[model samples]
Target: MFPIRDHNPSGRTPFVTYALIAINMLVFLGYWGQFSAPGLDQFFYTWGLVPEQILSGRGGLTLITHMFLHGGWMHLLGNMLFLWIFGDNMEDAFGHLRYLGFYILCGLAAAALQIAGDPTSNGPMVGASGAIAGVLGGYLLLFPRAKVDVLLIFIVFFRIFAIQAWIVLGIWFGLQLMNGLGATQDGVAYLAHVGGFVAGAVLTFPALMRRGGVQFWRQTHGQPPHPQAKYRLAPSHIPRVPRK
Candidate 1:
């Protein structure tokens, strides 16, 4: 399942989120043609976060650079989508500058955790999944009751459902934790997701408490501070076929 949007609207324009999306897109486009280059792998290794290099106290800048790189178009789009959906409200909550700082910190924490998982591996980790995971975590804490529209696809069927933020985020986090625990080696960095999420929740805890902790939840009912938005999807046009 993937979140299509949310019912919470920010009172002010989320400039930082918009800028981030633009930058990610531009960065991807800038090196789009380098995928087939003979030195491409070396390029990624130099810029992407490699646990081995990090452990050796070299390539320290990769932690930040890797956040802007992606393995493919889908990789970039998926991350950008998550950031677009949940980032605005966070930028709204933390303000522009502070939100940027929080995002970087979460990414750093994510990279650290992923590296710790297998520091000797030479595989390069790229993409913004970790940082976006942090945004998801923060969204969950501040708006557990907010409504999120998610697109769910079955083998031959498709549907969209609006669910509570907590349910959506909880399931996402649980999956990350589960996958991280399972024995597997693949492109996806599950540990990064887990780390960023935990970092986000921890970092945002102070803000939550500053808003009065339990009182904050009570006051807003775990929803956005502004009026809740309502959405109605257009009916599907695909004809239903009778089964034999």
Candidate 2:
């Protein structure tokens, strides 16, 4: 299942979220032209987080730079979509400047964990998934009851269902943990996802406590700080055939 959107709306404009999306897109477009050239791999190696390089104390800045680089179009789009949906509310909670700092910190934590997991791997890891997982964690803590629209595809059948944030994010983290334990490859950095999520939740705990801890949950009821949004799926318009 993939999240389409969320029912929770931010009280103020999420300019930082928008700016991040723009920058990521612009960076991707700038790098797309070099994909066909010989410099693409070199670019990734130089900018992307190579675990071995990081472990060797080389390319120290790659932990941050890797977030803006994506392996493919779908990778970029998927990461941006999650960020777009969940990031605004996070920025709303933390304010713009803090949210930006939080994002980079989470990404750094993610890279550090992934590097620790495979300190000798030479493959360069890239994408914003790790950082976005952090946003998911913060969202879960702040709005566990918020409704997120998830699209589920079952073979030929497809459906869009609204699920609570806790369930969705909990399941996501569980999967990441399971995969991180079961897999032993350089394909996906499941450890990064796990680390980023934990970092986001832990870092946001102080804020949650200042908001009255359990009292905040009682007041907001796990919804947005303002009001809960209502959603209705558009009616299916496929014409029915006349039966005999």
Best model number under lDDT: 1
CA lDDT of each prediction against the hidden true structure? 0.90, 0.89
| Tens digits of per-residue lDDT for model 1, 21-56 | 999999999988988988889988989999998898
| TM-score result, candidate 2 | 0.91
Q: Could you tell me the TM-score of candidate 1? A: 0.93
For model 1, where is the 10-residue window of minimal lDDT? 230-239
Model 1 lDDT, residue 95, Cα: 96
Q: Which residues of candidate 2, in runs, are more than 4 Å off?
A: 184-186, 231-244
TM-scores of all candidate predictions against the true structure = 0.93, 0.91
Which model scores highest in TM-score?
1
